[model samples]
Structures are given as C-alpha cells and as structure tokens.
Target: MASETDAPVDGVLIGEEATPIDLTEQAEVADASFAQVSQVQTVINHIHGDIGGASFGISGSRTKSRRTSGPVSGHEMAEARTRYERHESYEAAAQQLGRCNMVALIGTAGTGRRTAALNLLHDFVGGRREVVVELSPAYTLEKLATREYRKAHGYLLCDWPKDDVDGSIADFHLREIRRRVRDAGAYLVITATATSLPAGDQILWQPPPARDVLLAYQVAPEIAAEAAAHITPEHAMADVVALARDLAAGAPLDQALGRLESAGRRDVVAWFDAPRSRGELFEMAAMAFTAGLPEASFESLLARLESIAGIGMEKADAVSADDPMPSRRLLRVAEGSLFSLSPGRRLEFKVASHRTHVMRELYQRHGMRLWEPVIEWLHECAALRDNPSAQAEVARGVAILASVSDYSYVDSTFLTPWARGNGVMRSQATAAMAVSWLCLDETTRSEVLRTVSSWTRASAARPKFTATLAWSGELGIRFPLEAVRMLWLQIRNSEKPVRHAEIALARLFAALTEATGNALPMLDWVARQISNDKRIGRAIDPLIRAILSVLSARADGVGIPTVTAHLRTRPDSAVPLAKLWSAVLVKRPHRRDALAALYDAVCAFDERDDDDRDHVRALFAALVEALPAKERPLLAHDLRRYAISRNTDENRLEILLSLLRVFLSPAVLSLDTIGKHP
Candidate 1:
C-alpha cells in the first residue's frame, strides 16, 4: 500500500567527460522503476481510469452495423494501434499475424484478438492494390467458391463454426476454402471462437495485464501512485479498453461502476437469448463460476455469452441450423460474470458476495446436483495450496457453497479431505454437513446422535458441527425436534467440557426458542440437562449463565418450579444454583430456598479432589457477595461452622479462612486481597 513515487529511485548519471555510458546499468535502473510503477499504477488505474487517454473504443469503436464489416475508419484505426502497443504480447501477436498464410486466431471476446488481427492485415496490405474481404460467421463454403471470394487476395472470417456446428463439416469447408485461395494465389485469415481450428497455424490471444491498462490510458505517475495504495495487482482487468474509453469521455471513478454494470447487464441478457442445446445452455449457468471458458475445447461448450447471443452460423455452415432443437431460453435472466482473467489468464472471482448471489440462484433453480462438476473443479484447485492466491480463491468459493440450505443429494463423501488429510476443509465443510444432518429421517438421526455421544475423537470437528446446527436453527430453517433434543442430550452427556460449548448452547437455546415461538422447551431443556449431566461441575457456571441471559431477554414464561426442581435435586449445585437464584431473584429476591441451596452447597463440601474442592470453595465465597445485606449474616455463620469442621486439614482450613474473610470484610474478597490474609 505504500506510494510508488515516494520510493527512492536508483540513478546512473552520464557526465559529458565520460567516454561511453554502460548500457547495462541504465537498463537496470529503468527496469526497477518500471517494476515499482507497474504494481502500484495498474491497481489504481483500474478503479480510476486515466481521463486524458482515448475514449471507450474496445466494443464501441467497432462498426455498429453488423452488415457492414471491414477495417474501421482512420481515427479508430489509430486508437487500436495505440492500445496494442501498451503491452509486448499484443505487439508479438500483431507481428505473428503477418507471417501465417491460413491463420486462425482463437480467444474469448473482449481480449483484443480481433483488433490485433485487423492491425496485421492493415500492415500486410501496405500500399499495394490488394483486395480484402471479411466473411461473417454466417458465411458458407458455396459463397466462398463464388468469383468475389475466390478473386480476393485476402480474407477475414469472424466468429466462425458456431457451437452446434460439427467439427468435420467445418474442417471440410476450411480445407476447400484454403485450396481455392491457394489456387488463386490469395491469402486467408479466420478469427473463430472454436477451441481448436483445422489446417491453419493458430495463435491464442492474451489480454493485456493490469499494469498495461495504466499505460494504455496514459495515467500520470504521481497521481497513479496515490490511487494505487488501496488496490492490488491481482484485481481483474476485464474490459480495460472500455474503461479507458469511458474515462476519456469524462466520467469519474465513483460513477463508472454503476454505468458499467448497466451496460454489461444488457450485453449479457442478449447473449442468453440465442438458440442452443439444453446441455450447452446449462454450461452458461456454470460460466458464472469458471470465469472464462478455455479455447482448447470451446467447440464442445459455449464460448462467451456474447459470441453465442450475437453471432450465428450461416444456414449452410450449420448442419442443423433449421432442425428443431429443444429450447434453452429459460435461463435468459441470469446475467453477469463475477470471475475475470488473472495476469496468467486463469479465472478468479474477486468478490465473495457476487459468488454467493450467483450460486444462490443457480441452486434455487437446479439444486446441488448441478454443482457436482463445479465442486469437483474447486476440489482440484484447492489441492494446490502451494499457490497462496489459488488457496484463497478456493477458500472463498468453499464459504459460499457452505451456506446452501437445501440438502437434496448432499452427503458425507461430498467434501473429501484433501492436502494429505490435514482437514483444511473441516471448518468450511461443517455448515454443509449440518444441512446433511438435518435431512436425516427420524430413526437415522437418532442412531447418528448415539455415535457422537463420546467427547474423545474428532473433538474439534464436533463443536463446529454443533455450532453450525445452532446457527442454522436460529435462521428459522426447520430442523427435526428429535435432532434438537439429541443435541441437548449430547451436551449433557459430555464427560469433558468442550471449548466454546457455552456459545454453542446459547445458539441452540436461541434456535429452539425461534423454532417453536415458545420459551418453555428451551428452559425445560436447560433445567433437565443441569441435573442429568453429572459431569456438569466444570461447565455448570457458563451453562447456567447462558440459560439466565436468554430467559431474561425473552421473559416469555414463569416456570420457576422446573428450574428449582432441577437445582434442588443436585445437592452440590451451589455455583450454578447460586447463578440461577441471581437471575430468578430479580423478580422475587425473597426466595428462602434459593438462599438455603447456596448455604448447603457450601457446608456439604467433602474436600476430596484438591482442584474440585478449591473451585467449589471459591464459588461459595463469590455467592456470599451476591446475597442481600441481611442474608449475609446467615452465610457468615455457615462459613464459620464449616471452617471449624475442616480445622484438621491445612488446605481446607486455609480455604475456609478465605471464605470467612470475604463475608467479614467485603471489599477485600478478591484473590489478590486474600493472598495477604492471616
């Protein structure tokens, strides 16, 4: 995030007395400065385009009239040349274009492949009297054999061999077209969306990097450094040409996204309206995640949405152009691509929220079965953790997919642990597993509950799973009553208290209250678990506090009997019982039995395990402070008698003195204050 311009620049100055400057040193200095600027400037320029550069011309500069296809006018031609030179790859592609006779250029839309092809053709023509004609995707072999097609010395075919067009049929057409052109001593250049073209040298078009975006827009160094502080180089450079053009037309950075989103939406909607197979159309829905389809097998799938919606094969070029096919127009409403090209041209989605929105709709329509292939692809990428960028992308997708509420076809083996079983997906996969848990039939749900009753193995995975269930329950999504009951039972049955168990219980308490619209079930469940779970000595205080907090907030019921019965049953429940009294006494503070329970729990201590005895002794000392001023006298007498009973044991006697001092001198009851006790 540091300013690029603020960094010290390396220098190698040449004086007039010097014979010849070392070119190597000068090159090093220039490379260092370029590297510094490239990282910072590209990010800033992407969000805020350079206003002084060329206006919106990537798509806008192209001739609008579909029927009129050829080289653009003089001014537009100049703009394409300037944008192409902003990167070395564009220059290389342009140079390569002139060398090949039958050249097939393959690339996704908006990658500047067509523009590079046109530039090469312009240079190839030079000042000679050479004829040039561009055939549309709709062109046929029969049309190419005509005098006008055969007589032309050069040719350009745009978006040829549509998705449904057979490979053999398209290849036969290409072979004959090239033969006729070679026989006539003419040249041909075809720019098609097909994955692999037949009989021609092919070039894959790579889009300019983010840094080149700043170069194409003529962004100033100082201003770019200031803007670059907040963005990173990995940010998507989609439609950079359009961005530069928009900025050149005087739009500000703040207003550009809104305008861009509106325009992008219109283009995406049009692409969905074209005719194609149901299977191919389904792939378009998946395109929201994959970013861009690769060219190696573009014919096997749909290309850019624009390529299909905007271009169609000539009736002759398409084998089934007239045959009736199933309609795929139901998905016309789903629009926009969250994924964009990285510097390596690999697909990545920058925003998590956009991914959630797209996946939500896709699931709502076709369900999780539709996501099997996408999930498999994500799993494959996730295993490459050595690449931190890829790991982060996979993590984001995992988070979005985890939020899926529907459980149809979701199972245990769905998200297998990868990276040598390190359990990287454990946390993210917990939510999805919660959904699967909710889907079980009553008998199976109960049997599954009995399986996890122990608190030993997979302890980490259990708490997260329990928390996720409580989380979903609070959202008003229905889980079986038996499932909730068994969860509460498992918490009660736990031999060793789980970390974050209190938080998990609170969420479950909230979920139960929301699910039934009543507080009695939650209160009853909490009261029963306190008495039934004998291992509650450690987790009791937190569990009671969680119960009290929820009960006070809702204040929906007055079931003191159920609470008192559970507390009274546990003779050693002073710590938790005292907390229960503290909450209940807010309404009825004069409850004598609640005070009696505290006194008995204090006097009944047997001092067997030193840790348990010390913990209980501290609980009783704390409870003395919570009692009313008048009630303290009775607690004082009980503490004094208990001190005499433990006089023979040094540790118990010391603990007793600490408790008595708490009642006799309330301000000095703290552990630090007790340390200075006689």
Candidate 2:
C-alpha cells in the first residue's frame, strides 16, 4: 500500500496560531506502515485541549475490544439493501468488514424514494461507517436534499442522476462532502451524476478544501486606485475635522448627519476621497461647488462615495471604544464621540465594525445588565414574529451569560428548534459539566442526566452522558467509582471519549484551582483515576509518569519565590508532554552525547506549528527548570546543538555556543585536551 504523505488539511486547522492548549504535531515517525504519518513534523494544535497535530492522524481498522452501541445491525441494513438487488451482498460485505473504523455503501443512486429509508436503516443498524440512502426515487433533487438532513458524511450519502439539475445538487453536495472529511473525518467521493456501485473503501480520494489556494486576492491592489478616480466630494479634510470634534464631544452624530442630509444635493454621486476631518468635508464641498459640478448632488454623491471602496466617511461621530473584544462586556466603543486627550485630536466617531453590532451597542451603552433587558425585548419581538435580529441577540446573550459562567441560565429564546435539539446540547456538554462535580444526590444527579440526555440527539446522548460520567469521577464526586469505570468501558472505543475526558479534566483542574489555589495536587489525584483502570498500569502509567514529572518540578518550593505562574495549566495524564520533552535529552547515536542528543530533541520538538509554540516553550522552561543549578551549564551546552531561539540564534546554534562557552571556561573544562573531562 502506498503511504499517505503530507496532505493539506482543511479549515484554519489547529495549531496554526500561537498559544494553543491542544495537541500538536511534535515528533516524527519512523515505524513501518506509519512512518509517513509522523515524518512530516507539524505544529501541534490544541482542540478543546486535546493535543494532537500528529495524533489527529486517523488510525484505520475498528477497535476490537469495544461494543457497538445499537448493534452489529449493519447486517440488517445490508439485508434491506439486497432485497431489491439495488445493493446486493450487503450482509456478506458488511459482516465481513468487522471493526472497520468506518464503513460506507456505494450504489448507483437513481430516483428511488426508498434510498433515504435504506440509508437511515443502514445508520440505525450498523453505523460504524458512512452510509447514504439517497437514490432520489421521487421529488426534485433540491427538494429531497433540503427535506432530509443531507450531510455529506456521517453515515449518510445522497445521489442524484437526473438531468444533472444544472449541477447545483453536485455543488451543494460538494460543500457537505468537503465538510465531512474536514470536520468529521469521513472520507467522501461523489460520483457526480453517475450511479455505479464501487468496491470497498475506494473513495479515499482527497477533497477540494484540502488543496491550497493563493490567499492573495485575485483582484489587483491597483484596482482601488483606478476606481478612486471617479468619486467627487462635498467635504473638505479640515471642515470634517471640526464636525468630528462637535459630534465626539457629545453632540449626536445623527445631528451632524442630518445637517448633511438637508445640504440639498440633487441626488448625484460625489466623493471626498480624502480623510474625513470636518474641515476636509467643508473644503471638499467647497471645491466641488467651486468646480463645474452641481452642489445639489453633493449629499447623494457623498453617501454613495462613502459606500464605495477607498472612500472616507465622517464615519465615527462618536468616540466608541477603540478595541474589538467579544468578551469583557463592560468594554465597548462609543460611536460619534471624541476620546483623545488632546483638544484638536478629540474626534467624533469610532470604528463601526462588529459581527454582532446590536449586542455590542447595547453592551457599550449599559453593559450586561441592559443587555439582559435588550435580549428580553428581542425575545419578545421574536415571539411577536417581527424581530429578524432575534437570533443574533440571543446568541450574544448566551455569550454574555457564558462569559460570566452563569451556565444554568443559558438563554433559550434565541436557540433554534434545531439548536435545542443538538447544538445547545453539544455546547452544554461543558457548561453543565459542573453537575458531575457538584455534590448532589444520586437520584437528583441521575434526573439531571436524564434531562440533559432528553435534549441531545439520540446518537449523542451516550457519548455526552458517558463524558459527564467520566468527569464526575475526575472531580472526586461522592459517587461510586464504578459508575465512572463503567462509562469508560462503554465509550473506550468511541472516537469522542478522549476528547470529552480531556475537557472534563480541564474543568476539574479549574475547579481545583478555584478551591485550593494549586495545580500540583491534581497529579496525586490522577493516580487514583489511573489506578482504577482494570488493565492496571497499562492504560495510564505513561500519563502518570509524565504528569508526575511536570508536577514534580512545579514551584511548590518554600518562600513562594519558586511559585509557578499560571497554575491553571498543568500537564494532563493523557498528553504526557514530559516524556515527549525528555526524548530530546535522551540517548542518541554517535553525534548523540546526552546533551547533544537533548539539543537535537529540543530542536525536533521546537520545530512545531504556531499553536504548539507556547506549549513547546513551556516544555523547554520545565526541562531547564527541572535541572539542578550545577547541571544547568552542561544542559545548556547540550541544548546548543539543536534548540533554535530567534532571540539569539536557532536552538542548536545557541546551545552549541553555550556548550563552547562552558568548554572554554577554565573552571568547567580543559578544551586544550580533547580526551580530558572537566
């Protein structure tokens, strides 16, 4: 089999940015069959705290030890598929394909109405793979697609072979197909309008989103300059500056706008093109009137010009907030108001940009309290069926409430029926996670679980529920540990468990920090969780050792001088970053003296994605701090071989230089005699 080389991933993939709290591609692979999987060293991105740029690699083959939730009912779906000879041998192939990480069915889709029914059956019975049931037996292509949840992947496939429907169906499916591979890890291959059944797993082909495009805009930069020639203006730079002063000093911006509105332009297009100081507006208007163009069209021309690209607007009439922050509710911009300290610099107007402008405005004016009432009003408006912005209002409301950790009060008026059905539940998985930790009666807790379960999609219930259960164990909730153990047993094979587990751990850590003001204790506690694993040390031993190393070196020392900053973040047993870091300093061949080898390891780990950089830095910090002062010079020298630091040189050269310094030191080594140790 051919190896999967470095393939481009879709979306702004994890680890692309700095300060990621997730997994990154840190190391390389040299193992056969999997060598390529790890060879392409990439930055590790943390997702919901699961670190895995490399671990993100999908390992094929079904997990052998875990049981399927519903049944091995792929057999039943296969049987239904064979009934019409439309998809024969459903059982023979479905049964033979045991423990496949994914399973998919391919057949020539026609206008068969039963196609959807068949696909649903395949999913309900044996959903270890992607299944599509749309042969489009009836109705138009668009109609069928819109009616049913026609996702590209996720145990569902839809096909249309009629008329090509002007190719819109293909385009629509293409988006979902690409989404399947990127978002959910389902590989997709659309046959366009063709309906030939294919052999197993033949659709490992790449999706279009995986291909890179030149991010530079196709429109040339010079186009704006070319277009800037046409707009005429009524405003002069100086006049605009004065106008901005009055408005920013608490004069209503609309008042200034009203003044412009009546200036009587005969509905013509004019643009000032220059900066919109009040003086500039006046100067430009004077120039336009002095010129041959009629002054009547000035306002109209100005409005149109302002709308066009590269044209200026006396846009900020109020001194709105300068920054754009989604969180920090009290922080907001005041539009049309001046904010600068200097008199002349005092200016009206502020930046007008926010995806959720309404909420942002409400926040600026009254912060969260008024925001609550505004959302209530929007909710009332939505109830009256008039507020089109209700959804956005509700979403912002949710964000505001969430930022404050008022999880119990999640706003529902903005939640779509579908959101209530699925999205909220996915989001709630974390918000309501405290329930697992909070002291509560088992009966009451069970009731809460049942209520939460009712809100989620049927498929999502167990995964979410199991995740919560694992969380409860991590929190040291006064429940039987067996419940936690059982939940793990149920989901050990599922793809989402580890992710949920990691999330649960993060929350558990947060709660501990809030209560104890420490992170080191979590290590000893982790031992309890891992020790309970039936497989004994096999499951969490590596994590135990790894977490221990990070914790052992943490600042629990006396006098508080050694106190580690950012106690909220600690190594999780799952990530075992210490082990990964130690590999750099460990044994290497020939060019592999311990320090030199460690330098190389640091280099390898350091060459990671942007998101992983901080984590790598943290690892570097921990490793250095862990060493005794006596060994610091030796280790620093070893680090010179590979560790690259932009501040001085790359990690290697820096480490190598430090090592040279140590060798040159009279107290450290006698460099004149190569064979002699210091």
Candidate 3:
C-alpha cells in the first residue's frame, strides 16, 4: 500500500541539515511502533465484475497486511485549509481538535470529517517539517517490534479494519499504536464514521448548515435561506453541495435534484414532493383560494391545518403558521402577519398538471381525518354570495367531496340552489351532486329521498334534474319507491313527454327492483298507470325498454312475494310480469326460479277472472316454448302439474289449453302421462 504522504521523503526541507525519513521507502519491517499482522485474518468472498467482472470465489489471501498511514507532507494542504475556513462548524471542530492528544473526527459520509482531520493536523505541527505515519490494524506485531520503525511527529488512522475483522485483534493493534505514539511523544488523529471507531476526544464534523453550503456555492443569503427552510438541517448542506456541483457542471434540473438524496435516505425523501414538505402548503393554499387570504386569520388556519394533520399544535410547529421559516410555496403578506399567493411567484400549486396529484395525496392521507372540518368549511363557502367565482368555488368543493366520496353534503339545502344555476359551474355542481347522492350513507340517502320528495311537491316550475336514477342504479343505491310513484304520476298527468323524467323513471325502476329483489312494484305501478291511461303507456314504452335492459343484465329471479302480491292485486300485472320473465329468461335461462315464478303466475289464473288472464297465459306460453331445448322438459312438467291441480274445470281447461298450445311448439315434441296432444 502507498504511504499516506503528499510527496517522497526527499521533498521536505526539515531545517536543511537533517534529512527527513522516507517512511514510504522503508524496508517491510517486522517490528515497529504499531502492531503488525501475525495471523490469517478473516476473509470475504467477492464478485469481481460479476456484474461487469468475474467473481473471486474466496478472498482469503487478499486480506494481506497493510500499514495504517497518515499524511506526511503539505503539498495539497491548501485545499484542506480553504474548506476549514468556509464553514463555521468545520472551523470550530478544527479548533477543538488542536487541544486534544488523540482526536477522532467522526461523522457519516459527506459530513466532511476527513478534511477537518487534515486541517487539525496542520494546526498540530505549527509549520514544522514533520510527517504523519498512519497505522493499520493489519500490521504484524514482529514488524512493529523491529528496530528501524521509529518515525516522525504523529500517526493518523482513518476508516480501517473491516467490520468483520476480529475485535480482540483490532483492540490489540489500537492499544499498541496508542502506546507507540505516547512513547514517541507524538500525536494520533483518527478520522472515521461513528459506527466503526472507539469513543475518544471525538470532534463530530457534521455537514455545515445549509446556509454556509449555499454561501460556498455563491447563493444569495435570502434565496439560500428560503431553500434551506424547506429541508432538514442534516439534509440541507448535502443537497446544496450536490446542487451546486451539478449546476456548475450544467446538469439537468432533475439529475441535480436526484443527487440530493443518498441511497439510505431515498424512501424518506420520496415523501417530500419538491425536496421539501409542500403538502401542507398546497392544502392551505387550496383553502385560501376560496376563503380569502388572512381573512381566515392565522390561528384559525393553523387550527385547520393541525386538524387535517391530526396532530396537536405543539407537535405540528414545523409546518404551523407560526413557523418562523415558512415555505416559499406560500408568501407572507402584510409584514408577515398575513399570508397569500406571492406576487409574480406563479404559484405551482395552481398548475393543472400537478394540482390533482397534490390534491390526491392531501385528501387520501392527511384530509381523511378532517372530514367534519372540511364539511363545515364547505358550508361556510356555500353561504357566500352567489357570484360566478363564489359559485365556482362551491362547485370545486362539491367536486372534492365527490373525489373523496364524502357524501354528507347531498342535502337539498346544499344542492338545490347550485343545481338550478346556469353555466359550466352549475353543470359540474349538478353532476357532482348526483355522484354524492349515489355515494351517501344509508341514513343520508334516506334523508335525500325525503328532500327530493319535498322538492317535487314544493317545486311548481318543473325543477330540472339529471338521470340521477341512472347514476343511483349504477352505484347500487336503492332508489326511493315513493319517488318512483310520484314521478309516475307526473308522467301520467303530463300532456307531453319529459325526457329526463323518463330516464329518471327508468333508473328508479331498476334501482327499486334491485332493492326489493323483484320487478313487481315497478311493473304493477306501470301496468296500473297504463291500464288507467293507455296514452301514458305509449309515451313510456322507451322507459320500459330501458328498465328491461337493466333487469336483463341482473339475471337473478324475481321474488316469490313480488309474484304473489302482483297476482293477487292486479290481473293487469300478468302480461307485463310475463314479459319481464321472458326478458330475464332470455338473459339467464338457467334461472329456474324465474321460470317457476312465471309458471306459477300463469296458473294463478283463479285470482283474476278478467280476460287479461288469457293474454298473460298466452304470453307466458310463448316465452316458455322459446326456452333452449334443454330447459323445455322441466318447464313442461311444472306447467302440467299446475294444470292437474287446478280447483275447477274452467280454470283447468284454460290452463290445459295454454299448456297444449305450448306443447305444439316444434321444440317440445314429447308428451307426458296426461295425454299426447299431437
């Protein structure tokens, strides 16, 4: 190994008469002032360019003896001197090192400990022509005992002795080296990370505060302070140094920023979006944009921030309003008492590109616990005067509510006024309100139903509403049965068709059927309205198709209660129920319960003496015959059994005729024990 000296022995002028010792060119001695290697130390297997080199399976022989060495000449000592003067912390450490007999400069990498050690050595010599011999734990004891081993002023040891090296061996070498230095009346200065070295008169050379680092790179004090405010003290200096070097080399901005974090801190750094914690800044800015700056008051704003952050005021002081070093993400206005968007600053939080990402992080992590506070703040905003911007702010709040699925704001008091407005804000607000309705808790949903019910009665101007029923159907929210009945009456009484009303009616039918597990109420109501007024039925045929489409997608059978209720109450329900059964059967023929219910309804002919029963039975027979061949036998058996059990001949004959007509289908060729019809 090369000796830790700046030049060869002949270079130094030690008072002109005495020749300086060539510590580098000395014989490999078995005796010296420091311990030397005597036994085989531990070995490690290493990959030599296994990535780009071949592997060395075992590195046992490679653990050879190495002498610990130190800087011997002042050739490049000027560079070390300049770094010492640049930062106050380094200068302080150098001064402290001058007074200690054995000083260890300890810190993490990039903390500048070695520079301080070399500078401290410079102070120790007082410009004398002396050299520092660095000792290694690997030196053999016999080599240390050799007579030719006496050296100059002091010894230097830096990060040495690999961690897995035996502890007793390392301690023996360190003790021998200290004895050699003390016996020679010489100095010993060791520089290492905190993890490796023994406790001593240690001078911790932390990276300078960010300000000094920025100043070193020629950053203006104010700008540097602003940047410094964004990062922790431990990180600020390293980031500044990396940034300055990259900027000096004209590296790209991202590349420069990427170097700010070392590998060990990558995960912690990822939590910060811009080398700083800007999440709180963006959230407060979002609140300010609508609430009016400083008008909200600092204490009140801090409380809101604290609430969202879910921390007490004292614990949240770093990002608090009282933080002396506030982020440039927001600017202090009015002599720092109030805050607002900085003039000419072009607030990045407002940019559409990053806005959603910032908002998502805020709501998903921080604002999750602030739901009640956010709702109250929104209520305040909603009370603002109905200007376009105020309305737009309220609309934005509605959108935020939708994004987080916070649906407590679906009340008529919050929604009705904005729903009636004109323009883009109104449109967005209307859609957002519908989404909120669909996402509301069951209790809130029930409240919304009552509100809509009241609104329909109280509203005479034919209030405009969207296909909210459709949205509810999509979200699986049960549409209110009362709203469906009320909307059906409007359809029946209207002289002309209302498009939105029809869409709403269709969605309500699907939602109610999904909720009640049957289409009976919806079908009964529609059939009753149609039989009472055929004009309305013709007007609502499109709605019927839409509802049927929704039901067909949901392949589950209609409930038995639904069939029994409709069959007992309205004979008119048979044909419509039969049609629904056909629609469901066509989609899912394997739904045996639907087919059985359809058959049961057709046979419940005794409950209805009207002529509609024949049409219903005929429709049922046609649907039954249309089933795939595999499904025909079981359905025919069910029908024949019902027919035989009929209480009267007229009922039995009506059913038999329907059954016989069904058997005539080309697909149904078999005859059961009752008789062969063909």
lDDT of 2 at 474: 20
lDDT of 3 at 33: 6
What lDDT does each candidate get? 0.41, 0.30, 0.42
User: Which runs of model 2 end up more than 4 angstroms from their true locations?
Assistant: 1-420, 423-497, 500-518, 527-678
| Tens-place lDDT digits, model 2, residues 1-678 | 111122122123356643311111211110110111111111111111342111111111011101111112444346435323222233433332233323333332121222323443444333444343222122233443344333333333333233244455545753443444444433222222233223353232111110011011122234323322321232221123223344435455445443331132221111222234533333232222111122332233334333332233455564368845353111211232211112332211221111112222233333443334333433332222222122222222333332222222432323222122221122222223223322121112222333333332223332333334233322222222322333333334433223333323333333333323434434444445443445432343333333223332212111111112222144232123333333323312221333332333234433334423343344444444333445545555545433443333555454446444543343343223222322
lDDT string for model 1 (1-678, tens) is: 112233222223356332322222333332332222222222222312333221111121122211223433454445546655435655554555445445766765445555666566556553133355555333455455453444434566655543344777756665676567666655666665553354345666665664456445765554334333422322223345555555556566545433442344334334445554545444544444333234222222233322343324344366665687644332322244334545654443443234444454556655444455555554554443233233333333342343432212332332323211233323222332332222122112221232222111233333233332322231111222333344454444455433233333443443333333333433444555554644433445444444444333211223232222222333234344444444433333233333343434443455564444554544544455455666555556654564565453676566566666666666655433322323
TM accuracy, model 1: 0.28
Best by lDDT: 3
| Candidate 3 residue-wise lDDT, 126-212, digit = tens | 434446554542223333433133444655555422233466765666566556655665666665543233555566666666656
Which residue segments of model 1 deviate by more than 4 Å?
A: 1-63, 68-82, 86-92, 126-132, 140-154, 162-176, 182-187, 222-238, 246-678
TM-score of 3: 0.28
How far does residue 424 in candidate 1 sit from its true spot (Å)? 58
Query: Which 10 residues in a row give candidate 2 its minimum summed lDDT?
Result: 36-45
Better of 1 and 2 by TM-score: 1
Best by TM-score: 1
